[model samples]
Target: MKRIIGTGLCLLVLFGYPMTVQSQTLPVVQRFVLNVDYSRFWQNDSTMYIEISTAVYPNLILLQQDSLGFHGKVELNISIQNKSTGAMVYANRYNVPIHLADSASLVRTGSIVNNTIYALGSGEYHVSVIGSDVLDRTRKDSSSFTVTVQNKPDSLALSDIELCSNIIESSDQKDVFYKNTYRVIPNPSCVFGSTSFPLVYSYMEFYNLNTNLMYKITAQIVDAKGNVKKQRAHLRRFSLPNVVDVTTLNCISISSGRYTYEVILSDTLGQVKARSRRPIYLHNPNVKAASAETIVTARAEFEGMTSDELAEEFRKAKYIAQSDDNNTFEKLSTAQAQKEFLEKFWTRIETEENGKSNLSRSSYLGRVSISNQRYKSMSRAGWRTDQGRIYILYGEPDEIQRFPNSGDSKPYEIWYYHQLEGGVQFIYVDLTGFNEYTLVHSTKRGEVQDATWQQLLR
Candidate 1:
């Protein structure tokens, strides 16, 4: 989620997707790079409008205090080549003055956001943007992607869906993002969920409308497998031939997944017209498990699921379950019984302050997915590994000291948790050379505390 600084909280320049590359320097800086994308709208038969937006990590550049404020300069080269003729159709080299929105980017979520518009003909073009910190050419990034300019239709038409963090109705004409009596702040990263935007907004233009006939606007959130997770529609009639439509979806309750925000235009008779779609990734970890009454209403839905499936969902959540929960769940023989128990299980957890555990089903599973990537061993699943257990149990460690193997000892790592139980350390040593580290010592109470654990490292 890339956003602007100072002016607002954070902002994105939602344009189009661009893949980034580096110039062989320490690629660690790659995390703090730039995002460049473009959205195409039909302008005329001979040309189309390519609206390009760039969100840059200011930390990647060197800034100096100037009259305007703390700012840096960046060199950029953008080119669009005709794929059919192997010739460059457009190319430009310029310097963009990068301004610091608020403070240092390291201390906040901020980016240098800017937008540009170009007019190109209807065809397939290969677009590329190469940029560098002007004072430090060695720190550079490049991106290239394909852009397809579609021809305009004579009937009702739709433009590319522009996802936004906000849509403000403003009368200021000089605003950088002002459009159609509104300001559309683009979220080019195509991301939404917890800790950021709980609602995703869309801005689009509809062309060649039938002013005399009534119309319908249908909006849907579709999954990867083409299943519609959510749908909404509204009836509208326009006095003008074309109009801009903006819609929003409450993404708070939608589960974490990859989805498509689609908008469809239909006539009063339910005849299909125009449609537009944009990809979105949502991570809604803060959504609480269903409430007591909500669970009661949904019990029948859960009972429709197989008893085995319901048990598996319970099993995956066993890390936080009580001893009695396991006993009761294991004895459930029918789907109805399992569904009732599952409802109670979630409802009870919604209020429990068990061990200060603050977890939603989405967040817990999210950590499990992350652990699988960080601690997977060859012999077993990552969650079954010793390190995975500590990670899932205690969250992220404050510090880690990794010791490589030498003649005197095997590779080992000591994880530090400063705030838990008055500061504790867990030590894992790779007795085997296969990177399978085993937990051998801990300073925490009720755990292995072998003073001679170093001897085993040998």
Candidate 2:
């Protein structure tokens, strides 16, 4: 195995930004984009096992270009604090090396996932992880979560479920991935779908099982609204007192969104014993859209929304909102005022059928969900992107003309709307080549229009 670089750095090649100094001296500070997650298991009566998993984007980090292509690195600083005594229990750092053959390979490689495990005494503790771009110290992200690890060897209980990218049979005990005769790869970002990770593999530990007793394990995929989307069950009679189990689900047929990967344990008599649940996000673009049930029930559930949540919803709704409606919301700093404002705004904006208003709030929101699932990019949410804005403001395009990279040309797409303005089309160009296409031209009214759009491809 090759050693990876974490905090150590070579000669600095930092990217510069324009400042009052007027020279390219100051580096632009950006968020070190990544996701950190973990799972807890009983190692013994007095100790607990903690595995920290991180998924980070290689394309998002700053790198130096050379004959070897793009080279960069990221580091994760992990710390465990004992909450009872307000003391630090454990600390360590890990490295992730990134190598890209060229710019185009960035989108295809997706994110790099890494894992590290630690053992700590059974107690309540706070775990913190800080991710940083090794070349740019100012670019970093930090997150923390509390865990209560308890002794479970004498009880019939299951450990915290570990979401994974892969699990394969392995005999290489010396390998860092080797665990319980299998190589388990964790997906810290918890993103799965067709364009992203398609298989959802869950690894968990079962303890204090009776060899003669029959047990049942139920695995389910639940949507954000607590609706079960897919489920299956298995039965087994254990031959060992403690064992590890791996279960997998194919999310290709499921819609993209935030959901829960949950496991339930029960006995032959259907008595529930243990359950573990973790949130996961799926990004299955074009496989399936979000369900209507999840969108339709969202309105009645918006009673206690925070001010930020209310304002964001209004921002999405602003695609169809008039200037006056936006101005009205800008003054609504209070939750109650924003909620009341949105109700009246929707009443005036929702589509009408047979001289009566229908539930367009849910309908519009469904479009937003679909856009977010299909068109999201590395820099911004799909709902905020140019293509997503168009999809929400208008319906789907009648035809989409796609063009991949050709000689002297960047990848671009032309979306045509047959009904809008009699005949209209929107052109998006991948100026960055990371799939963050920008709208350059459009024939539709009130849209960005560039008559010489062909120059952009050149």
Candidate 3:
């Protein structure tokens, strides 16, 4: 009897029918798909617009293939929420049907699609999308995005925009003042470079959100210590074409460091206007590496000198070192010889415990170091030749007049310094060889007679 029942059940299964099967229902799955082509929208007056599309898919079958089925509606809700305060400033909802042909490729496109929205005020906002399938099973989906709301011209007002580094105590509670929008480029903390620094500002339209006109713009530069170093109020008439264009306010020669800049925009009456504040940090290049050469040369020169003699030499040389060699001096085979030479060179110049070196002795050794680093030519260091002697004594001139490729006149550079007593100028000419700069003339105080160019030869 049991064999007969099992055989009967097997025959039923082979015929696509089960005799003792339990009925069970599976959960339906729904998917909501949404996408936005443009992520950013500009605020125009009280209205803002965005473009979006959404799609929905159901995992379960609701009706037979040839039968008409009740389709559910899709709901999309978009809201603009403030990013800073988490406040919902604007919200909107739209409902549409999910009706499609049984053989309509299972894809449905939304009909009532709008890409624009209007809002009031200027601030940061977010957009959210929500969807739901109104079938027997309660299935829903949601997603969100962000947008920025900017102030229009009509919503802006010019008031006493006083900008100060610190708050001031006053009798009136309404005396609180904030800074106007102003930015300094290549911030004070920045090192000098080929690029120029700029200061930028913008104006807001008062009570009008659509107005793009910005009013009176002025910029001021303060030093790292918060002291007003430079002020340019004439820029008040300047207007920016766009918010991003305001970065053109950068200035030149703004040293690197922490700096605070204030921008004031006002009307014709000089009344204070819209204000914004920004802090800037400019970075200076690592100059510590640059001075390494100076330090190394000083150490090498003072290898054998006493502390007192070293101090006197530094004072007379106006600098500590005689060579611009960044590497430490190495006297592998002739260490004693090199040490003895260095000591004799300083001992001959030491007049007293800490007195100045004798005039006959070479005191401007630091100048030699600078010239060797700056004016080397033809595989020869500047300090190894005659031209080096002049440079070491007088330093680089205020002006250098070059005679390039002039076969007859010869090439030369004129060094000028007005601070020297009686105004000194050195005329360097390439006398011995090509591309060589040699001091041929030295003029003092416009009197070419008392000059001492030949003294370098001796």
Whose TM-score is greatest here? 2
**lDDT (tens digit, per residue) of candidate 1 on 1-458:** 11112122343221211222322221222222445656777777556787766555554456554333445777768788989888997787777776543343333544555566777777899998787887678766666778888778787888888877788899987776787899877764555665457788888888888888888999889864587777889999999977889998878776654568899998889988878886676655445434343223344547457755776678667777865455345323335555655665665566566553676555666777777888888886777787877887678999999999788889999999999788999999988788877899999887789998988887
The global Cα lDDT (0 to 1) of model 3 is: 0.39
453, model 2: CA deviation in Å? 64
User: If both were scored by lDDT, which would come out higher, candidate 1 or candidate 3?
Assistant: 1
Alpha-carbon TM-score of each model against the true structure: 0.54, 0.59, 0.24
Model 3 CA lDDT for position 171: 46
Using lDDT as the yardstick, the better of models 2 and 3 is 2
Top-lDDT structure, candidate number = 2
lDDT of 2 by residue, 103-160 (tens): 5555456567677777878779998888898988777767677888877657787888
**Cα-based lDDT at residue 331, candidate 1:** 28
Give the per-residue Cα lDDT of candidate 2 at 271.
94
In candidate 2, where is summed lDDT lowest over 10 consecutive residues?
4-13
